[model samples]
Target: MTLHCLPSTDITELPATVSNSTENPETQTTAPAEKSAWKTLSGLLPFMAPYRGRVILAGSALLVAAAATLTIPTAFRFLIDRGFSLPANVATDASASATAMADSGIAAGQVNSVFLGLFAVALILALATALRYYCVSWLGDRITADLRQAVYSQVLRQDPVFFETLRTGEVQSRLSSDTTLIQSLIGSSISLGLRNSLLFVGALGLMIWTSPHLASIIVGLLVLVVVPIMVFGRRVRKLSKDSQDKLADTGALANETLNAMSTVQSYVRENMESDRYSQATNAAFDSAIRRNRNRSYLTALAITLIFGIIVFVLWLGAQAVIDGRMSPGLLTQFMLYAALVAGSTGALAEVLGDVQRAAGATERLLELLHAQPAIASGKQSLVASSTADVAGLGARVDFNNVNFSYPSRPGEQALEELSFTIEPGQTVALVGPSGAGKTTVLQLLLRFYDPRSGSISLDNSAIDSLKLNELREAIGFVSQDSVVFSDDVYANLRYGKPDATDEEVRQAASDAQALDFIERLPDGFNTYLGEKGVRLSGGQRQRLSIARALLKNPPLLLLDEATSALDAESERKVQMALERAMSGRTTLVIAHRLATIVNADRILVMDEGRIIESGNHQELLAGNGLYAKLASMQFNAAEFHPAVEAVRVANSPC
Candidate 1:
């Protein structure tokens, strides 16, 4: 079940202070306490600025509609006073009676004319209202679309560090629920508030013109009603923000659980997960109810105070009419204006609530939109070298005394003052225990995270100096946990190269040993892979991932346990394919299985975030270091199936 964007109410005023997520360097600080809700909402002005003409048109139409509505009571006053009141006793005599009948008929015509005039005013109001709604709604849809797009774009540009603190579910909540509140504000609430505000002012003015004393009394009483409502509204805004945050929390919990459904189900924790989700939703529900309760109280109090003033004013008007201080028609007009004022006041109270809620939503979204990623692109781009040039002298990689720590774990280093180098077209393997900084090397090379000290150079140029896109685009990566998008096979392959031809994709798939399985699938290349490629086997998904990288055909390839999922036979076959693919490329392999990297030109055995040994397979074995121990443990162990054993035997001569 999804949480909806709920409109909230207000209580006492509180300071608005929103904190930005830590990963965003620019917006990581808290907003000032004194900032008002209206000021927070003003952030949307940039989104609305492009639609200025439509806003003006809508505003003009609103003004016309309100004016037309106000004119109707004036028409009513004229109809009552002029149409019924006539020459005294004109209908008494025969000839006089005939003259009186003619005069009466003319009066009837005047009444008909007044009714027609009222209809014309009503028609104008309808047209103007329609125009206003169309324009306002169009602006709302357009602005919301732009805002969502802008926020999503900003989200895409964020790096891994950003996601470390801000969960995917929370971001999704802001994108959906928060944007929805802003849409409601722009489409419905703001227009209604403006229209009602105009009506209130116009009605109050006419009331004053009709009876100065009565209007003055109402104006004073309305001030009393408004002051408390404003106080309640501020509190409602804070509660609304709290409620939205709780809803976001529920979304985060559901998202985390759903994404790891297999893990939850495997552990037989369905009921436990359900209970967890239930608690989160209940918390959200409780928050919403609390916010809504305050809103209800405010609503009740507003209606009571506003109508009570209207009743008192009506009583005063009645007295004035009875004392012959006011005419019946004028009293009728005054009463209509008073009713308009009362209705507008009530509506404005609700609009104020909506505005406060939207202000909270706006503040949340602005935090995201204004976020600046700590990892930004550089101005320089990698010069595209020829495939032959790469094959002959592939991209040179050099790391010098680099030290780093994950932003979330600032105290513990993920990589020490380590150093490494790869010559062009060389294949290097890092075989070590888990958390030995093997994958960290690949990530550093990818520039996913920059080192704390020292520099990495690519072909004599600093990787930091190169544009992130260009740097990453020059390397192909396949991780242990292969990621496959929920799309057709052909589309997934084409994702590596958007403009890749069908033949190129098929060739890449064949090279990665994925073509056979892909062909056997229901629709061949067009088969729909389920979310995260759940429709495919572990080995098949890896093959697809490998194919994507092969399609990219970058100067450097990094495979982190790429063949870890394959069966003995599939591993042998893919091993052959990988061998052929690596012939003319610089490659970095992170493997726990020594059999996979037995033929590497060099192997860097790492432990505790530092490389302890580096040499060819034979040299490392002769050195009798961590590499030799690991190789012996693997080759002697029953972990190697016959096909994998053959691969190791063929690549080694002890």
Candidate 2:
């Protein structure tokens, strides 16, 4: 059975100070601190500004629809009073019986005409409502697309430090779920609020006109519904935002675990991880339930209080009808208006809560967009010439009194006052135990982070003085992990030199000894490599990494434990390919296997972030220092690998 254990989590040092004063000026950039999102709604101005014309058109249609809805009550009033029922005085007049038949016929015709008029009003309402929906929905979709693009664009520019705090999955959650909430507020809630506000105002006006005494009672009771909703809606918004945060945590966990499924399953922590995810989801559910409960109370209050008040007022209107104080038609018309006012009031209560939730969501997305990278552009005049010209132009590298610690492991220096130099076309090896800071040296040269003190230079020019891309362009790297994306071989190789032609890519593969296996695959160079290149052997994967770097053909090459994971046979082949890759390049090898780098032009033995010994294979072996001890312990007589004739070295005892 394969053994699996959790990697070390214990930190031997505290985090680096937030101050940038000690950081090397050439690579240092500053980002503002995270601020609270109190003005988040105002942050959406740019995305909303582009759709102003559509917003205006949508508003106009909403108003027209509300007007049509309000007109329906007037049509009903005429049908009740003139078309169906005549005034009592008219029926009781002297010539009433003879004129009654004529009046009845006229009323019948008027009733049909009024029904047709109501139908026309409904048609207008439908058309206006549809147009309003189309316009607002389009605007919402367009705005969300632009907002996602803007957030991702900013996120892509951030340096490693930014990712150290926040995760990719959390960003994805805000991009999707948070933006979706904003879309709902824009497309549905805002339009509903405006239309219902107009309906409430117009209907209330007519209710007071028809019966001021009744309207006064209803208005006073509605204040009860409005006040509680205002109080409870604020709580609901807060609860909803908390729920979203908890859900985002669950998403982040899932994303992290899923990407490392091999590790998770290999260790059999499936249930443990599942339980953790369950706990997170349950917490989210609890928060959502609290928010939903508040909304439920608000809904119950609005509907019950307003409708109960309407029923009581309708009872008064019935009494007035029986007392001959008002006509049946007027009482009916008053009830309709009262109902319209109640419905509008109920809608406003719900819309308020939606507005609050959208506000919180908008704050989150705006926070993402506001994040600035710590690697902002530094002006420079340096340019990398063609790869051919760059060989002799500027391949020399130097480290001057450099000291560094990872931001996360601040007190433990990965490198301390380490100074070294490499001439063009020299092969140097860095051999040491694990955690001896071999990889850290390569990281510094790429300018992923700046040294805490001192400086690094390339070709006698400060590296930080050149643009980051320009500096990186001069070097090619192949690490032990050999990252292989889920893509075709052609695309993977082209990642090194994006515009390289097919012939160039194939030639690079041939140089790395990857062409034989690649061509043997079903689709040859077009074959799809599974995620992390699981379809290929370790040697094949390493060679592909070498091929990618070879395609770049930079003047400097870095091979960090490049063949450490392969079998003896695979190692021999990859080592050969690496030798071919190192031709005419300044090569730096960080390796654990003693045999791999024994023939280097020079070898440096690092321990505790400082070099204890440096020399060629024969000199180091004869010097009898840490290098000699490690070499004696690791091999019988470490001249070279016996599979193929090893490179001629300064001294070979064998």
Query: What lDDT score belongs to each candidate, Candidate 1 first?
Result: 0.81, 0.76
Q: Report the lDDT tens digits of candidate 1 across residue range 379-429.
A: 775775333344565677888998988887889888888899998889999
The C-alpha TM-scores of every prediction are 0.91, 0.84
Model 1 pairs in collision: 9-236, 10-232, 10-233, 10-236, 11-231, 11-232, 11-236
Which candidate has the highest TM-score of all? 1
Could you tell me which residue pairs clash in candidate 2?
none
| Candidate 2 local lDDT, 1-654, one digit each (tens) | 001011111111111011001112222223334323334566777888977899889989888887888777667776676665754557566577437636566545666778888888878888888888889888878887898899889878777777776777777777877877777777776777777788889889999998999889888877776777667776767666666766777777888899999899999999999999999778777877787787777767777887899999999999999999987788888987887877777776677667666776776666668777655444453454233335453277788988999887898999988988887778899998888888989988887778899898777678777877777887899999888889999999999999999999999999887899999999999999998899998878988998999999888888899886677787777778778777677889998886788768889889988888899888888899988878766665544456323433324566
Error of 1 at 71 (Å): 0.7
Q: Model 2, poorest ten-residue lDDT window?
A: 13-22
Candidate 2 ranges beyond 4 A from true positions? 1-39, 89-111, 201-224, 308-334, 384-394, 636-654
